[model samples]
Structures are given as C-alpha cells and as structure tokens.
Target: MTSAAVNRRQAMGAGLGALAAALAGCSGESGPVRRLRLATGPEGGPYNAFGQALAQAVAASGRRIEIVPVSTAASVNNLRKLDDGSVELALAMADAAGDAVLGRESFPRPAAVTALARVYVNYTHLLVPAAGPVRSVKDLAGRPVAAGAAGSGVQVVAERVLRAAGLSDTSATAPAPPPASAPATERAPDPSADERPLGLAASVSALREGSVDALFWSGGVPTPALSELAGEMPLRFLPLDDYVGALRERYAPVYTAVTLPAGVYGLTEPVGTIGVGNYLLARADVPQGVVRELLQVVFERWRDLLREVTAGARLEPRFAISTGEVPLHPGAVSYYRSVYG
Candidate 1:
C-alpha cells in the first residue's frame, strides 16, 4: 500500500480505539458509573473508615469493580438508604436489620436485603460523671440525659434502652455534640443557629456541664470520644447487663453479653454491657457475581481491611452464620462455604 494510505489507516484505527475507550466508561443502560455506591457512617465513624478501606483495597487489585463510599448516619439509616436503592453496600446493626427483615416494629414491611458479614460487636456505653449520684440505668428517671440525634442508630437504641429501664418520657436528647467530637473539616452549626445532628461532642459537653446526668453511646471498646471524655473528666460506664434480658426479650436475639475490660478507658474496673452485632448489608437484588467478588476483597485481603478499621478483623469465616435475623446473601454464603469447608 502507498505510504500515505498506510498512515491514514493507522490514524483511523487510533481514533476508533479512543472512541471505544470512552464508551467503556459506562455499563450502558445500567447506570452512569460502574463503581458501587456504598453508604457508610458519618465522617470519622468506624463504618466510614471501613467502607473506604474496602474500596481502596478493591481498586488496588486492578479489578473492574470500584466502590464509592457515601457517609451516612450508620445502621438504621444505612438500611433505609439500601432499601431506597440509593446505595449498595451498607453497615448496619443486627437489631435494626432484623427488624426490617422480619417486617416487625419500626419497619412496617420487610426490606429486601441479605446479610454480608457480622463485622463486630458495638459495645453499649452509658457514660455518667464519676462524681455524680447516678450509678445505674434506672437511677436517672427524671434527670436529663443525652440520647443520640434523630434518625441515628444511637437514638433508636438509646430510646429502646430508656424504655427498657422504664425511664420513658424522661431524659433529654442532646441537640449537638461539644467541640471535641465535631469534625474540623465541617463546623457544626451553632445550637442557636439551626437544628444540628447530635453527636458525641454534644453529649460529652452536656454531661460535663451538668446539663445532662448521663449519655448513651455504642461503639468499639475505648470509644474515641469516651476515651477523651475520661481523660478530661472522671467518668463511669453504667452496667447494662441487668437490662440485657429485658432488651433481648423485648427486642431480638441479636443482643449478646459482653464485658469491657478495665483500663480500656482508664476505668479501674470492667463493666458488663449488652453487645449488639454489627453487620455489612447489601440489597437482595445486587448481582451475585459482584457480591461474591466484593466478599473476596473483604475476606481474602483481611489484614488490609483490619488496618483500615481494626473492627473489621472480626469479619471472619467462622462467624459467617451469625446472622440469623437477616438471611445471608447467596454470594457470601457460597464464598464462605468454599473457604470454611
């Protein structure tokens, strides 16, 4: 062929290749982006960190799959987002997820979802001033307390605990957190400026200034905010073991017994508390292959996930069957059986 013709042909080929590459950006007809949108907890929360970690690991593998993490209110909120088709992977508390699956209280109808993995236990912490007179859950009947913000997992669980303690219609929910738990990246609105989400800082501040007698928080042992609370002031964690039976009887079997060791938060004594299982959740309709691959990224590279959020290390193969309330995603079950068996 003539030299000029050959050059022209090569130029055409290059242009066609570029066009094809641009088209490949989307799956076509399915969605705009290929990356799965995962709803995690609010900024700085463990769920947010865990979701980002999983995304980072999967992207590093050079796989076609990509994960985009969206910060959410965690647990119950995550489930709601998942149900609305706004997100795919979500981190939720077993209790909340169970309610949705069973089509019971709080959820008028069943939400279509399958359990991913029971990630870890969220240890409930009821913080009271060491110098204060309140020593137990029942002690603060009419006293003001810092329950969590609206629509948050904290708020839901706190309400349940309060009811279990027969302290319903009492205690006040903190409007906003103190400065400590507030994110530096985003300044919280002034309590007088506008309604704001209640957080650890608000609760801690309320507890410190004697506005609230106690606060209810749940997270891994040595919850960062509570840890800081201990350093700044003498704090005591109220034992919830006494109410565990009542909580389980009234709620579900997701509640288990756990004890926080001494020195975790500078406490000289261990405190018994009811532990709730935290699970990774996915919509029931997610492609089985995609779910299977994501599970691989989470479990196969377990150490990397753990590094991102230490609580994730607990997402082991043996505990695959721990989720009894919400049914397991077939993809996850298949993956676990192949490995565990």
Candidate 2:
C-alpha cells in the first residue's frame, strides 16, 4: 500500500483503538467517548513516565474517553505531529509551542496549536559529575555534552542555555543507529542532528564513563532516572539563574527563575536554574469536549496521579493558565470557568 493509504489505515486503527479503550473504561455506562493520541517524551523521561500515569488515570476517570500516549522527542516534535494529524494531544514546552504558532525557530510556518492546560514547570538541569571540573554552563565550551535527542525539547532548552552563556557545541558526533522507541512509533529525527550531543541516558552513561562533561535535562524535578543516577553517584547542577533574562529575550517571556531545593539529589545547597512550563497542547480544531475531558482528567484524578508520579500530581487549576504565549483550548477554558466560577 502507498504511504497515504497506510496513513489512512493507521488513523482508522487509532480510532478503533481509542474506541475500544474508551468502551472498556466505561464498563456499563452509556456514554460516547472520543479517543485521543498524546505525544509524550522518550521512553524513560519524565514526560513518558508521567504521561503513562496520567493516561491510566484518565482511562479510569469514569469518563467517556481514552488517551494513547505515543513516546516522542517532546515539545517541537509533538507540535509537528499535531500539525500532521498523527496525534490529537501533546506535551509541549510553552516556549517551543509559542514559537511554532508564530512560525519562528524550529517551525517552518505558522501552526494552529492550542493549550489544554499549563501542566507543570520543566526545570532545566545541567548535571555534571561532582568530581568533574566543569561547574558552570560557560565551562562546557570545549567539552563533550549530551544536548538531548534529535527533535527533543531538551535540545531546544540546551541550545538556548548554551547560546545565552556564549558557548557553542563544537563536539563531533557519529550517527547513532535508531533503536525501537516505544513499540512501533518512529520517532521524528532531531533537527540539530549534525551538531550532535548525546541524549539524556547516553549523557548519563557518558558522564560515568568519562566521555562527556555534562548532560542537559529539562523536565519536572524528582525525575526518577536522574534521581537514581544521582543516588548512585554525586552530581552537581550548573546554575542558570543568571541567564534567565537572556533566555527570556531569546525565547519567550515564559522563562522564569527557579530553585532546585538542596538534597532533592543529595546536594547541600539549593541550585538555581531557569524553568519553562510544559503545556498539554492540541490542534485548535480538536473538539472542545475532548479538551475539557482531558482537563477533567487532570482535575478529577489528580490525587491518584500524585501517588503514581510527583510531577503528574502538580496539575493545579489556578496554574492552568500559566502557559505563556500559547492560547488555551476553548474546551479547557470552559472547564476552568465551570470550576472557578
């Protein structure tokens, strides 16, 4: 079959899966459910872990819907998938989502994405081995680093952090063979593949093997993988607190200063860093009812999710409007209004 025919079949298959899952969740309730596809991050990343937990909670919300979380590179890549109709919902960084809607940066043209909720703040981390000499972002100038996988929001954050610090990635990278990501979903290629840096896991491994100086991570804190790695070995965070203004100027106004409390990773003092909100995004044309239901998953099943994932529990209706320049989905607005008013 041709690519077009294949895509049509995929859509039909996705629709069928969505229907089946929704019906399974309903048990004996008589309600019509719309299935949605959620574009999450790489397999082990916070987005993926938290997204999976959130998906389960939604499936059990006693609502008329089902969500399929597809592992992706996050943010920009998710937005691109939204444009192509490959996914109906996506976990995107506020900055990348804003840039896509404006047809700037990674996006080639204007995108019609809207926000379901400003979920949580993604705290950018520049982690280096405690014994390693590199202690700041500026010290990474001539060192090997893992900027994040291709097309990942982690890469987007890494690039901006580097540019603000007046450093450039001159590390030479060899092509990495693609591995199966989350069953059968083909991960979109990273745009900055030519200027290679290792991905998160690879960077952590490299740090242990003494190949790379540091790795950049932008996700909710108490990230399980990083926590486990830090527990195994001492790690230090290079502060990005000073460059918040430069990052905001270069990206969007959504950037803010945040402090990673000391001891979350066993450090003695708090670490300062820049943060960006990660939004639950959807195409502007997705049904308002679906968006409202997605938001409902966040509000209704929040406590259960909190037990499942710390980041997943951080969803608050008050902070739901924090997604910087990205406009809210009408369905979300309706849901929020019903609650707050």
Candidate 3:
C-alpha cells in the first residue's frame, strides 16, 4: 500500500480505539479520565522535551494530558500562568522561582507555587566566535554584544553580570557629550551605539555574521543549536570562574559552580561555569490527588521517561527537596515522603 493509505488506516484504528475507551467509561461509574494541562517552552527547548516525557508517563497511567508549547521567557511567567489557572504545571529556573515567590524583579506579585522536583542545572554560557578578538567579559566593554532576549532568564542573568562589571544598558546606549560644547560635526558616536540585546537565534546569527562580538545564554550543555553553530564557526565558551564567588554572594544561594565536560559539545577541554537548577512548579491550589498521581508517575517511570526525552535524564529524586527559596507544595511533600522517606 502507498504511504498515504497506511497513514489513513492508522488514523482510523486510533479513532476506533478511542471510541471503544469512551464506551467502556460510559458502562461504569468510574467516570471519564481527568485531563491535565502542562506548559512547556519553545520548540527544541529543554522544557518542551520534559513536558513530552511527563505527558507520556501520565498517558501510560490512563490519564489524559495536553502539553502546551510556550516561549522561552523567564520562569516567572510560567509561575504566574499556573497561579492564574492558565496552566496546571510549568518548568522554572530556581533563581526565577525565588524572585517570583518574593515578588522581586520580573514578578510584580508574589507567586504561590510549589515544586514537584528539581530537573537540571542551567549553565550561563558566554560564547564568542573563536576568530573574534574578544577573549574576556572585560573585552566586551565597548564591543557589540547580544545580551539575550528581553524578559528571558538569560537576559536577567546577563544584566546582573553587566552590572557587576559596572556597565548598565542605559549607559551603554547613551551618547557621549561633545567636548567643550564643540560643533555637532566634531562629536563622536557613542561607543555602544551598535550594541543590541536580542533573542537567542538573533544572537547566533549576529555572531555567525561577525556583527556581534559576544553573547550570553543560560541553558543546558550540548544545546543542539549551539552544537550546530560550533560546527560552522569556531566558537569558545568563556569561563566564569573568576566571578563565581561574587555572583553567589549577590544572588540567592541558587548559584553554584559547575563544570561542562569536553566531549559534550566537542570542546577540547572542560568549561568551568556557574549555573542554577531548574524545577517543576505547580500552583498551591492545584488538586492534591492530581499532583500526587503526577509525582507518583514521575518517580515510578523515571527511567522510561528518561529514555523518551533528554530533559528527563536530569530528573533526580534527590533533588526534589533542593529548592532554595520557594516552599514545597503540600502535594509534592506527600509524594516525596512516601518515596524518599
């Protein structure tokens, strides 16, 4: 049979199976299965993969789940959406979670959310073209740079780093005063005139085109897009070891020193960096039974889930209680105690 015929047959078979399941439910008082909505990140992002794995595990338990794809903004957005009943679950960074619960930075109001588990550490990578003259963060002082997308965790962290270095986005864009009130023709353009803060894809494109000297991104090691970019243009991941202590002191306790291995992205040597853990968050008001069943499925089918997605490999049970600022949800607490205690 042609490929189209095979696809049509498969579709009909799935429809028949769904009809049978619906009829079976009508025959009993067990009621229809509850459906959960999960919010993930953009296409080809870690959150998207994690959501898919969780949805698959929930499906295996005879529950219905719909995973929604969202943009890669800061975790605060995810927490807010969950609190407002827009989404049942979300993935968030630990630092972002801390800020949200405390009503600081991007979160205008306090977010009442609880954690299911800690997923993975996200490294803040400062990358530059290998052929570029920029070697250190200091070298990027007057150079064109992509500070990452607006409202993204990467942009938040980038702003913090720039402030630590005594640079402000406002100052970077301000025009220098003319000497001694000289004529406008004698005035020079601002050194930072060409600088721009852009999205991840734009940053990569700028670097590839030799238009930007550096870019900062907070993500997991071996990001597929970064790997592909490295293959075409020589790239170097900068080490942030020198400022690790200062970052930890200024930020919450979520910051930690981490080492990225050599072979993960075809680098010749390990890269030392600073990172924070990412967590799964749910509103405090979510149904206890629903949260309990979700966590149960996570721990029980962890290996199978890991096999299905890259992000699942970071779902370690030991990290469930490792959140720094946000309080654990009562539902998550119950599940953790039953499994770990």
Clashes of each: 5, 2, 0
Candidate 2 whole-model C-alpha lDDT, 0 to 1? 0.78
Candidate 2: residue 193 lDDT (0-100): 19
Pick the lDDT winner: 2
Colliding pairs, model 1: 176-202, 177-201, 177-202, 178-201, 178-202
Give the per-residue lDDT digits (tens) of candidate 2, residues 66-102: 8888998777889999988899888888888888888
lDDT of each: 0.77, 0.78, 0.73
* lDDT winner, 1 or 3: 1
Off by over 4 Å in 1: 1-33, 170-197, 307-313
Ranking by lDDT: 2, 1, 3
RMSD of 2: 14.4
Q: Model 2, 217: alpha-carbon shift in Å? A: 0.5
In candidate 2, residue 111 scores what lDDT?
88
lDDT digits (tens) for residues 61-117 of candidate 3 = 775434344544546567777777887788887887888888887888887777877
| Models, CA RMSD each | 9.8, 14.4, 10.1
Q: Name the regions of candidate 3 deviating beyond 4 angstroms.
A: 1-31, 64-74, 170-195, 303-314
Residue pairs with backbone overlap in model 2:
150-190, 151-190
